[model samples]
Target: MEFKDYYKILAIDEKANASVIKASYRKLARKYHPDVSKEENAEAQFKEVGEAYAVLKDPEKRAEYDLLRAQGTYRSAGGSYQPPPDWQSSHAGNRTHSQRTDENFSDFFDSIFGAHGSDFRQAEDFQRSTNRRGRDLHYKIALFLEEAFVGCQRQIALRVSEPDQNGSIKQRDKTLNVKIPAGVTEGQHIRLTGQGELGIGGGKAGDLLLEIEFAPHPYFTVDGMNILLTLPVTCWEAALGSTVEVPTLRGKVKLKIPQAANSGNKLRIKGKGLISKGGEISGDQIVTLQVSLPKERSSEAKALYRQLAECESHFNPRQAFER
Candidate 1:
């Protein structure tokens, strides 16, 4: 695994606060969203960004990461600092020994952090006394909006490393059958017991925390549990109240537009948003109205517009701005 510079990826100062880290993550995530970005290796870059954020976003992890980085404790293949005999034994007692290994990191990260391996025996010993379960591993799984509305099952592949008979570490692939419950919201986590890193000694294995992320829909954006959609309506539809068919995560629904409704008006559909886990709590869908004008106007249309203009000659739309 290569060393990762979390501050560099976020383009923030070392003293950046949690809010700054969160803002940076949002900006970077939007830019590298797989559905929209065409950048080379965008997916890889995005993953790297996520990893960086995952560490920096948490105060405890960030502090530990900063300490290790400052100590120059990491040893890369070509680094001048060499570990002493049984270096693992020296730091074996450190709580962050496993984290320092960076085994889960990429080669690029390993190059920076230095290639280190965890001492399974030491970890096992530590667990024998504490009897504490291992920390849960978190992963983000992206789904479509429809999938959020209708539950689905997904087969997920995970890579794990284990010690071989010779004590060398080997990578293994594990497939998990995950059931996505309906009404699952983005940022929510599903816990799978004994699916994370194995516990040391006889302790219980860690739980796998799978965070939900929704794919960007072409027509809608989600906020909290509410769904937002910018629906284009004809001028007549806005001037004359009409019931229009609108698309939702479930299906098409009829929405009533009040007469004289203007562009940018928002209409709410109650209990039409994402359902809660227990199928009891619900949210709303907000539809923003947009009035589209005809690109090409007929002669009669121009005449009618001129006639309307004569009646509204005194109306100065920009008067407020001028004042």
Candidate 2:
């Protein structure tokens, strides 16, 4: 068997960290995924990459491979390469890391870590079993506040693991068109049946769990199911009621400001927020009033303020201070 340089196959430094190894595997896996990749021999290259990751991702396997490389055991010029003479007598054969069968790997890999003796038959039999369910996958999706309020449909592509007739796992691309229901809050999970990793043998496939997250909005804040907004108004509007246009998830609506309304006061706009998942209850929009004053007052405005202060002179706005 030809010696396989797992590090070179993964295109990483010999001393690459665990995170770097994992990241490189994902990038290369996507690049050569059979369903999406257009490169020549894409399927073969994809398999090689997966094999490299399986060895490098495991610390024990990587250490053993490194030792072989360090001793120049595999650097021989012969067309075939083999492990040290004592490899079978050592712990390499019984080293249990991956659950995959020796056939999933090349003869070079089998030479180092393959099963031996009476246990070999049991291992082969176990690998052929088809009663194990596939693995479930989790993915996070971000939605705009508007989309969450009214619901939307999205199409997403993902790389999933599948087993061939030989029970060897392969990477493949799967696309799903998903409907995001209205009122999906942050951290909510939407499960799609049998959309995850393919099961071994004839076992059932796993489900895909999509975690929901909300993108930040420039004009609104969320409080549970309620939508919160700070509506700015002139000081005069607060003292002597006025009608103003307020933005809601549905659209803009005219809101009535009660007479003598003060800053920090909250007004509830019923049934204007998010809807319940079952469509039974609707949250109200909470509008908080913030009174604003003119930054630059004209001479006429100053005179009007003086007259108003005089008219309300007995109101000593801070009379409680004297007590």
Candidate 3:
């Protein structure tokens, strides 16, 4: 039989304490457990890990195995090992046969520590607790800004893992209609209770954490609960007061532009922005004013502009440069 290095199997140092050995076993068991792991050959790997833990967890079995390793009695001749004649475990008198037949330990394990080598009951106890809960699942829901502003219901299709009658995990199609509440910010999570992977061994099912992501919008930008919009206005409209229609989350609304409003001026419309989830607080929509000049001007319009330029000739807007 090939020599099975228990320490190498567990990926631990030879001087590892009992706690480190148990910790490594638990981590590997969870990673390779057939029920939840997506790893290839998970069942075979899990069995190997369990067999390694079984031997290392027992004090008497570990001591006997260590002595055999230290003595180098087994050699790899033609990829096979033969034990020395009259080889016997000093702790064999204290060895107790385990009733665990579920685990098919390797022939190498039986050669060193007899047929029922280590106390598999302890390993089983750890495995049972480590695999009790199902793994939590995360799903991202991409929403438009309007959908997040106002609550909406979305139907999503997912393939979830569930245990069958024979205690084997199977993938089943699941559909869920999730109600997204209003005022959800980016990176927010909406949890669905018991909607994730089914628990192992009758334990409680894991929760599905729905992460909220917003799709890019062409007309608007979001800042926390506030919404920003850029409104274009003619030079006359900015020079003189006017009421213009502007787009908001709800719909288009009229906004009054103050006289002498310059480009980059901001107008605040209260309560027109995104609402809070609690409905107790409301955000304001901020409109930035951009004065747009006509690309093609008529002769009469050019003459009027020249007349206005003559009227404001003394008003040097760049007077600060004279200092």
Candidate 4:
């Protein structure tokens, strides 16, 4: 079997401190976790990361691995992998660290640290008495801004660890219809109780926290609970105020632009952005007006533009810079 470089897999330097290693592991785990990640081959990548962390986190295991690497028993990323003599002769670690990689770990790792090796009895005995509370799960879900304005239900499948019939915790998949509440903003969390890992020794199951993120909209921008929209208008429409139809989450509404409105002019429509659960207006939608000029004009229009330019020739737009 080809050797696995735990350091390279974790994206950490060989001499990375424990804290840095842990941070890198957590970040990668979140990215590749099967429940939340839609990335290509995420499940496989997640398993690789887990195996790497399993070996690297333990100092004793790391020391043995370092020795194998130094003695040419192991390999680096994409390097030729060859075992040193007497690999299974019990000179290296003897399965001292037992964190559930027995069957899943690659043959390369198993050769260096034999499965159920010399000191396996102590680790097994220690595991018998270790009962841990269910671990809480964190995940992120994306929604359109309109969905945040109007509450929606989503069927999401969660991958969790639960107690099996054999009394051992194993990965289990569960699907839930989650109700996303209205006014849920970006980075806000929705907690689902009793939806996490199965309890040990009859302990209560932990909770699952779902974080909300908004998908990018083509014509809208978000600020807190408020929505911003840019309305493109003709130069004449901006100079001479016009009533225009503006788009909102609910529907299009009529907005009156004041005469002589310049670019970047913002008009607020109260109670038109989002609504809170208490039936209160969360925020208003702000429309920024942008005046646009036609690129081409007919002969009559060009003549009219020339006349208009002559009429306003005395007005110097660069008056601010004249100072």
Give me the runs in candidate 1 sitting further than 4 Å from their true place.
1-135, 200-203
lDDT of 4 by residue, 1-323 (tens): 78788899999999998999877776676566555456788767766776677677778778878877777644545675767665553434435455435545566666767654433444333222333457898888889988988889988888988654334446878888899988788888898998878655335678989999989999998887788999999989898899999999999999999999999999999888766676664789999988998898899999999999999999897999989
Candidate 1 per-residue lDDT, tens place, 166-214, comes to: 2233677878999999889999999998998654322466888999999
At residue 206, what lDDT does model 1 achieve?
Answer: 86
Q: Which model scores highest in lDDT?
A: 3
TM-score per prediction, in order, is: 0.57, 0.57, 0.60, 0.58
Off by over 4 Å in 2: 1-130, 163-174, 316-322
Task: Flag clash pairs in model 3.
Answer: none
State each model's C-alpha RMSD to the native: 19.7, 11.1, 9.4, 15.9
Q: What is the lDDT of residue 48 in candidate 3?
A: 85
Name the Cα RMSD for model 1.
Answer: 19.7
Give me the candidate number with maximum TM-score. 3
Clashes of each: 10, 0, 0, 0
lDDT, candidate 1, residue 47?
59
Worst 10-residue lDDT window, candidate 4? 123-132
For 11-53, candidate 2 gives per-residue lDDT tens digits of: 9999999999977876676566565456788777766876777
Off-target runs (Cα >4 Å) in candidate 3 are 1-127, 157-175
Candidate 1 TM-score versus the reference? 0.57
